[model samples]
Each structure stands twice: as C-alpha cells, then as structure tokens.
Target: MPFLISPVLTPGALARTPQPTLPTGDGLLLRPWRAEDAPAVHAAFQDRLIHQWHVRSCDSVEEAAGWIAQWQQAWKDESQVQWAVVDEETDELLGRVALRQILLGDGVAEVAYWTVARSRGRGVAFRATTTLTHWAFEEIGFHRLELFHATANEASCRVAAKAGFTLEGTKRSALLHPDGWHDMHFHARVHGD
Candidate 1:
C-alpha cells in the first residue's frame, strides 16, 4: 500500500478559461485587465498605502505591463482571476479587485482589492467587492470566498463587512509586511450565506 501512488495532475489538467465582464453598481464595471491599462495601474500603485498592504508594487509602466501579463498567464494556469474596476461612464480606472489563490477542487478563493488614491473614500472598493462576492458565490459556483486583511487595515475591514463577508477570526502574524509581521483578519462568504 505504501508503494502504490496516484498522479496529482492528469492529462488535460489545466485549461484556458474565459474572462468575464462584471458590473458592480452605479456605472462601475469589472473587466479583464488590458495592456493599455498598465499606465493607470502604475499610477494607482504609487500610493504608500497600496505598498503598505499589497507588497507587490508596480513601480513603473513596464512593471505594470508585466503585472498584467502575469495575471493573464495566471488565468490560463487556472490559478487566479483578476479585474480592473472602472467607471462605466468615463472608463476611468477606479481600482483593482481579484479572486486569487483559487483552489478549484475545493471551491475556495480569496478576494482582495484596492482603490486608486483619487478614488478612495468613494466606496469604489466596497461596490466592486460586494458585486464580486455575489458573482463568486452564484455565477462562478464557488463554495466559499474569503477576504483577509491586515488588522491595521480598517478600510478593508469595513469594505468586507459591507460586502456581507462575515468576519471569521484573526490569524496571528500570518502576513509578513515590510515593517514586520501582521495579524490578518479573515472574512468569508460561503454559498447560501
């Protein structure tokens, strides 16, 4: 029995999946990231807060372009899904939201988001998160979606609550920040929740 083994990845294991355009609310939409959006993404990540929490910083346009490319490859790898939150009227970038760490076999995902500096306090993150939450639960058929944030990130915590993601608990020193490790608060929305 100890000698017997099974394959973890079989033939046709990973497939390229279609990306979707989702409408959050009030003329806001979540669309697939485009190469053209790299400039805006670069500008948005310039904020200190974004770097404080998001670790990965798109310091330049080239890095931003690479970021988008990596996300595209992630989609093909069936590992993550991402979107650029935009204003439907002006087509201006508001923020970015993503369901990463996707475990398809277990039907689990982690939602994360950030607003452009100019879009902060406008509920851009909240609306996008709320809309994405529903989509992940119903349309995408995921059993559970979770959102985790540093305990010090009050804004993100508020957004998660407003999006109907219940706070599960805190993981002590689970995230390593630039300054030090952080205790991350966990929030989740399960199917039928």
Candidate 2:
C-alpha cells in the first residue's frame, strides 16, 4: 500500500502530536522548517549537483519562498514533515531532509534530501537521515520510510547504507533525468527493525 500525506489534519491536531528534535553529531540539528528559512533554502538549491540528485531546480527566489510557505502550512496540517538541517551554534542552514509522499494509513513516507556541495561527504546526509528516521518512527509513528537514489549517484547510495536503510531493489526507468531516463535504487527502513 502507498501512503499519501493526510492533508486534512488541522493545526490543533498537529500541535497535539509530539514532534521530537534530533541532534546530529557535528553540531547539527534537525527541526521543522520555518518561513524564515526561505533564503537559505533558496541558496542551497542553486547548486547544480543538488539539482541533479534531488530533482529540484528553482527558477527564482520567489519560487523557493512559495515552496517554503507550502511547507510551513504542511507542518500545521500534520501532513508532510520538512526539516532544516542547521548548525547548532550559528543556526545557519546546511541542508534539508523531508518526508514527503506520506500516506498515514499505509504507514509509509518518502525521504528526500540534499546537502550543500561544501557540506557534502561530511556525513551530513547520513546523520540527517538517521536522525530523521528516528524522529519519523518515534514522533510520526510511521511504519516505513522509503528512499530513492539515482543509480548514478554513488554518494547517495553510500549515505543510505550508512544510515542503515535496506537496499530493497531498483525501479527501472523510474525517473527522467537531464541525461535520460535513469534507474532508481529503492531503500527502506521499517519500524522496529
């Protein structure tokens, strides 16, 4: 079964639901996305590598702001969970990890992420994914989390492995990349191991 984000949950409902803050080893923290984060989010997505891996290409700052607004409302609706990976000391944005395509009934959500090029290979994605998974299971009560990495992206595959997600298989011609239709590796983490 596929899980869709429950769009009907109200702010009060979300407020009553406990959300846990996750701390990363290198002075990074994962928490809910804020409207004020629009600027940083916009800057992070400008990288070509980020676009290739995450399938995000924003045309302008306004576009990023618009997306952030939607994410803010998503937090209120208790549907999709979006988090900003921030430096604990300076509170500077480092990247983002989000659980989208969420289906509450099926107990599943899709995890996607991007780390700024400068921050890549620093275990940022690994730590963030692990922390987010723990929060999703503990706070959101999801039974499964799914991650899809482009077959061409070895770094992402490594990140998934480090985060302890099982490589389930591949979806052939799953995504249309700039180069061509590409294979996608599916990884998953289920509740309670």
Candidate 3:
C-alpha cells in the first residue's frame, strides 16, 4: 500500500490533534467548544463584523448549536481545528480561532478567527493566533500556515503581523463578501518563522 508519493504529502496523515486547553498568559485559554456555548457563539456571530467576513450566520440557538456540531465534525474529519477563546478566570467566551482549509499532504493550512465585540481592541486574536500557529507548525506538522482577510480588514492585517505572519500578497477577488466579491491579502508564516 506504500507505493506512490511521500507520505508527508498526504494531509492529515498524522494522528488527529488531541483536544487540550491551550493557555495564553493573563487568564486566556483556548479549548474545544462546548454544547453549552451555543448561545454565546450565536451572540458573537450577531456582530456585523463577523458575518461580514465569515459569510455565515446563525438565526437561532438551534442553528448555532448546529454550527458547533459542524465544527466538531470537521475535527473528526481531520480537516480543521477549532477552539473557543475563553477567559479562564471568569469563564467567559471571548472569541474563536481555527485552522481550516487544512492540507496535511501539502504541509499547510489556513487560519481563521472571529472575536466578540467585547473582545475587540484586545490582543485576543493575536495571542490566540500565534498560539495556534506554533501548534500547527510544531505539533500538527504543518510547514506553512496562511491567513487570508479582506483587503478592508485592517484589524486582521495587524493581527497577522503581530502573530509573525508576513504579507505574501493579494489574491484578486479570491473570496466573496456580502457586498460582492472582494480582494484578499494572504499572510503566511513558515515553520522556522
């Protein structure tokens, strides 16, 4: 059965990442999402900034539950890793961070995230993102991790920079936004970076 190409080229060939609480100093912890988090997640997505970039929404708690369910399945499929960014002291859900579009074969993946309005202006996204990048490159065996955001998303650009991602360039109309198709900037971090 070992005939064709290098085993490393096939994505997700390594064992799935075990769910663990990834901690960042100052009481932040990134852990797997829980069923009880549906309401909070729903509320977070209600922010215009979130739906504007994510191109997805949840109208009801039921739908939010489904969203959580879908991410859970993505993990089982080894196609994604999602975590709820929480404040360990108060146990409040601050945001979410995930590595999606995972190509284990190519040793690469894409990072995505959204934070609640309350979490905005904080370093939540940057810290959580940096933590995830390290895990992807060191633990998940990915050589590169890329982050794409709408050209108009200045906050994300800053986060990418602060997280050690260098701007690679723009992808013309690479993603569709609510107003119409929009250009995207691709920021990346290699293994040694």
Cα lDDT computed for each candidate against the true fold:
0.86, 0.80, 0.86
- How close is every model to the real structure, measured as TM-score? 0.90, 0.87, 0.92
Summed over model 2, clashes come to: 4
For model 3, the superposed segments whose C-alpha errors exceed 4 Å read: 1-5, 9-17
Tell me the RMSD of model 1 versus the true structure.
3.6
Tens digit of lDDT per residue, candidate 3, span 1-193? 5758664545445334456678886678999888999999989989998988878877999998988898878777878879999998987999999988888777888999889999899899998998888777776678888899998999999999999999999999998877899899999999997
Two-way TM-score contest, 1 vs 2, winner: 1
lDDT of 1 at 74: 82
| lDDT tens digits, residue span 20-119, model 2 | 4678766899877767777787888888897776665887778888998887777656677788888888888888888888776677889988888778
* Model 2 TM-score relative to the real fold: 0.87
Off by over 4 Å in 2: 1-15, 18-20
Clashing pairs in 2: 3-103, 4-102, 4-103, 5-102
Residue 155, model 3: lDDT of 94
**Residue 67 C-alpha lDDT in model 1:** 89
Whose TM-score is greatest here? 3
Off by over 4 Å in 1: 1-17
- How do the candidates rank by lDDT, highest first? 1, 3, 2
